[model samples]
Target: MSQSLMVAFDVPDKKAALKLAEELGGGQGKTAKVGMELYYKEGAAVVQDLQEQGFAIFLDLKLFDIPNTVQKAMLQLARLGVDFVTVHAMGGKKMLQAAKRGLEQGALESGLPAPKLLAVTELTSISEAILKDEQNCRLNLKEQVEQLALLAKAAGCDGVVCSALEVADLHQVVGDDFFYLVPGIRMANDQVGDQVRVATPAKAKAWGASAIVVGRPINQSTDVKTAYQAYLADWQGSEQEK
Candidate 1:
């Protein structure tokens, strides 16, 4: 897929989520992210609903568990036929490997292509201070993210969910073949909210991000389509400028 924008469905229920999706043209080659909130409330039926509406789903459960348990969980997720899924890179190499294996096996059985397994590096919510103080880690924030990304790639993941702030360095370290799906995107004038590390869609594109996940800036707007189009414009850049 070309560099893309994935609208995050961060609402409380399926009705709200679907409404937002419909306002954005009911998918039709677009992608939607069903994160913890919506997924936990509505379950797999919502994913199927989105698929039927022609939305490619990114099921961001961020699974983290022992290798066997994670593998079992991934097996079930693979059967959903989502375009992407996430697991915590902090889960270690064994768990990441097991998760990939489960997806492969489950997709084969379901006669579907396995979702791209994206390992979550450090959350955009985590600041450098939090990394040193709360996580009690030796590595600095960038170093830690880079380390986890290497671990994920070694374990057979197709990509990683990371901050756009780290994309340039990660591209250097992890290479272009690995997908860098960034989240925590905010426009220049947008509020930072809970995310500490954030960037505009234009910066993300310039830094070579494979894709971006956007939420409140579009979702909370009074005019959702206009907000989405603005983001897409920044992300894709103007043809005249290009």
Candidate 2:
């Protein structure tokens, strides 16, 4: 399988999002992420449009709700035929299971392949202090992330979204088959913005990230195709080195 380099279509407007999607659609990366910002603005029609253009979508809503609500929502999302979607693992095993059940039912009804359900282990923007002090999490970040990832896997999730910082250890716990859709990717000189646990594409690839979700580095670049090429080169070179 070709390695996934999921670009985050984190723009606020539908036009800009569509334009970016069009540009990347002609590039090597075949997958793109649609988060709440654009989805709420443009709805599932945007996803359908992108899919028609031959790009797989990762709906990154990071859903966190009661089982019934999440299940209902996942049903709708699954019917859209997205390649992946995310739920908050912090919602506990029952919620994750509920999400899986919904995906299965929706895909069955729609005659589409069930989207891979990924659990959000932790957000990349959150720092150690926020986790320990504000969130009252006692375990260190790595330990907590591992615990969540195992919980997600046990709950029948196909994967988890973790920081590159936790990818290697997560692989040890979940084994190599579990997908790690890592975010918080930045080029060496790119600004980190709000992210706290950022890693370069080469580092993320070397550390065992199954795929990396890159945002600002590509989105903010003057030449998006070149930036994407650089990231692809980084990951491809890292894989070759491995």
Candidate 3:
């Protein structure tokens, strides 16, 4: 597979998402991310629509239920022909294993490529302060992320949705081939918004991220196409430097 830069289509509904998808044209090297809000509103039809439009769907539902429930849900999502899907590593090894099994089964049944199962370590919106104080954790941010990533790997997950700040550490521990999908990517001049562990695109690529999930910097930009192209340039330039 080619190196991807996923534009998060985290809009309100299917109509809005399709509008953006039309403008961006998921051709080039771009991929589309469908998160909770839009997926809940539009469901499988939205997935089908995007696939038909030539976009590889990165379904970001972050499944975090019991083993049986998560397995069943992944089984269904697998049939959608999504290119990527997320599950929370906090759900433990059994749940991740169950999810992997379900995804494999679904792919086998449908005779389709199984979506890469990415395990969520921690939300980029979360801070070290929040992890220590709010979440009541002893481990620091990097340690916690590393631990979760190990568990995800042990359970046969293909990759992790980690903060850009933690991607290097994860890469060191997990090595290459275990995907590192970093989120919380923002342009250097852009405001951070709700994200706490943000990094610029160049920084993310330098840290060896497999892919970066970018949202508002492109979506909310005044010149969406130019902004999107600028991000693509950053990633390409970074790769060439490597």
**Residue 12 miss distance in model 3 (angstroms):** 1.1
| CA-lDDT, candidates in order | 0.92, 0.87, 0.88
Report the lDDT tens digits of candidate 1 across residue range 144-177. Answer: 9999999999999999999998999999999889
- How far residue 67's Cα lies from its native spot in candidate 3, in Å, is 0.3
lDDT of 2 by residue, 113-229 (tens): 999999999899888899999899989899999999999999999999999999998888888989998899988888899999999988998899999988888877788877777
Best by TM-score: 1
Model 3: how far residue 73 lies from native, Å: 0.4
Give TM per candidate.
Answer: 0.97, 0.95, 0.95
- Give the number of colliding residue pairs in candidate 3: 0
- The CA lDDT at 22 in model 2 is 62
Backbone collisions counted per model:
0, 0, 0
Give the clashing residue pairs of candidate 2, or none: none
Error of 3 at 216 (Å): 0.8
Question: Any idea what lDDT model 3 has?
Answer: 0.88
TM match of model 3 to true structure? 0.95
